[model samples]
Target: MAEQKEDTQRERFKAFSHVFDEGTLRAIHKESSIGSFEALQSPIKIGKEANVFTAVKGDELRCVKVYRIAANFKKMYEYMASDPRYTGLKRNKMSIIYTWAIKEYRNLLRAREAGVKVPKPIHVFKNVLVMEFIGNKEPAPQLNNSSPSNPEKFCETLISNVRTLYQKAKLVHADLSAFNILNHNERPVIIDLSHAVDLRYPNANQMLERDIRIMCEYFKKMGVKKDYKEEVERIIAK
Candidate 1:
């Protein structure tokens, strides 16, 4: 039984190895050997730009997001160039994508420190990021896909998280929306922090307001009674 299990594990690892480039495979193997994860379980999401997978680490499960090297590098470059922190960055496509992954990891750490409900970042290498999984057996569904039973309370909680992220974390989630939020057991778990930026960024305030507006409009469409502009002002006031 032990030998059979070992063979099955080897076969699974071999299959996953084919999905990544040689360099990436080496990095993944290094991480696994160092105890980051035991094995790749399955893919959770395959977005146009990145692929998110679930991995096992001892008794725990984690999420691994891998950015595709052949993805839209031009768009990644454009986005990175706009961020004040990455200003004057080199024009290397792979470097830009790798930096983007690092940014997401750092942003999630900042958000977690601020008490915002987000996946805890585990490790990052090149264009791959590992984070705490949000669900038990399966990944959590996005808020857009799973509406909360209490829309009012849920919206309030989400707004509070946004405010905490901005005021305490000094970061703005430029792409905040229902699609990026995970409804984990009726609570909001924000994900996809790749576009989050520091408050010192030139357009940080504008981005914050836009995020608040998006959240308010989404809740309003779902029958929540609230003033979006007022909510934005209140959050910034703090």
Candidate 2:
């Protein structure tokens, strides 16, 4: 029975391998062999640059965000080059994308240590990141897709998360907005940390302001009466 199951899993992996490059397929297989995840279950999200898939690790569900090597490499390079941490980063397309993935895993680890409500970082190999799945059975919907019943409370909690991320984590979520946030059981779970940067980054303040502006605009539509500029200042003010 175990041999039969192994053969079945290999067949499934072979089918899934078609979706990625040969190198990526080898990396996935390597991760699976090392017990990171058993198999790819289904795609949860198909973002512009990365594909988010649900995978199985033992009995638990895991999220795997795979950066597309064949996608818009120029855009990915532009974004990554500006970050201070990657100052001496190579101009190579695949290397930059891999660095971006590794950066996100590191950022999430920092956020988790800071008490932020982000998915737990499990493992990252090359351009693929394995993380704790946000929801049970199904991946949690983005905040924009599934608005919380209590907009005010939700917004407050989200801002609090931002505060924790800033004060405690000493990092800014540069791409924060309704789309990157998940509304799980009425609580906020931040996702998509690729754009997050440390406070020391040269463009950190500008990215922080943009993130605040986006959240403010989103909450304004949801009827949260507050000044965006003031909120941004409040979060950054020591």
Candidate 3:
């Protein structure tokens, strides 16, 4: 039975073989062996560097994020280079990618510990990360795709979470946007912490402003209006 199951996973994995290298395959198998999740299911989203999938773990569900080893990680290295936590990072492709995933895992945990709303990280391997699936049967739609019924409330929640993330967590989600925020049952759940940085990063303030600007622009389109500068002040108020 186990051999048959392995064969089945191999076939299924081959469907997306373009992204899975031998290292990725080994990481996925390790996750399964350690009971990270029962099995990786269909791909949920295939992005520039990673692909997301829904997996089963006993009676519950999980999300598996696999970062492509062959991805164009130049931007990733550039982004991570300035972060103090990753100082002196080697330029090796796989090393940079793995460290990128590790940084995301650490950021997720830090944000969670600081009471910021984010996916609950379950496990992390070299380039794979497992986290709580944020949806009912199907994964929740991005905030952009599934417009919230109460734009005002949704905006407030986003702002509040941003406040928590900045003030309590001292991390700026450099890539914050509607695309990375999920409107899960009308509440916002932040995702994609790979680009988040600590408060001490030199560009943290600029990144924060950019994040607020994006949110403000999105909300403005939704018939909500707010001064971006004032919102930033409010979020980082001491």
Candidate 4:
């Protein structure tokens, strides 16, 4: 039965094999071999840098994110280079990509510890990460696709989450926006923490301002009245 299940999972993943180099494949297999997850079920989201898949883990589901080795490492390096945590990191492509995966795992851990609503990271192996799934039977829709029932209340929740992320976690989500937020049953759940940087990052304040502006602009369209500057002040207030 176990062998048959593995065969089925392999066939399912075969269609997306182009993104999985031999090294990444070995990393994924190691996760299963160690019982991190039972098997890959389906793709959650596929993109240029990373591919997220939903996998079975006991009675529940887990998300597996695989950072492609062929991704635009130059762009990743440029973004990662500014992060104080990765300062003086080797410019080697594989090392940068692997570090990107490790970075996200660490960021998620920090955010969770700070009481932020984010996917709970399970384990990170090389360029692959296993984390808690964020939805019910089907994945939640992105905030851009699913508007909230009460925009005012929802926006407040998100703002509070962002403030908590900054004040408690001391990290700025450099790439935050509606695109990376999941509207789960009218609540906001932030995702895509790979671009987040510690407060000590050179451009952390600018990134936090950008994050607030983008969120306020998006929420403004939904009838949530908020001044971006005021929100920024609110966030940065000691």
> What do the candidate models score in CA lDDT, each in turn?
0.86, 0.87, 0.90, 0.90
For each candidate, give its TM-score against the true structure.
0.92, 0.94, 0.94, 0.94
lDDT of 2 by residue, 109-135 (tens): 999999999999999999888899999
Predictions: Cα RMSD each: 2.5, 1.6, 1.6, 1.8
How many clashes does the backbone of model 2 have?
Answer: 0
Error of 1 at 153 (Å): 0.5
Q: What is the TM-score of candidate 2?
A: 0.94
Per-residue C-alpha lDDT of model 1 across residues 1-238, encoded as one tens digit per residue: 9677556656766887767887777666666656778788898987788888999987889998888877787877887787788897788887888888899999999999999999999999888788999985878899999889999999999999998998999889999999999999999999999989888888888888889888888888789988877888888895
Model 1: residues >4 Å from true position, as ranges? 1-10
**Candidate 4: worst 10 consecutive residues by lDDT?**
8-17
Mind giving the per-residue lDDT tens digits that candidate 3 earns over 116-142? 889999889899999999999899999
- Better candidate number, 2 or 4, judged by lDDT: 4
What's the TM for model 1? 0.92
Q: Candidate 2: lDDT over CA atoms?
A: 0.87
Model 3, global lDDT: 0.90
Candidate 3 has which clashing residue pairs, if any? Answer: none
* Candidate 1 pairs with clashing backbones: none
Model 4 CA lDDT for position 196: 95
The candidate with the higher lDDT, 1 or 4, is 4
Error of 1 at 98 (Å): 0.9
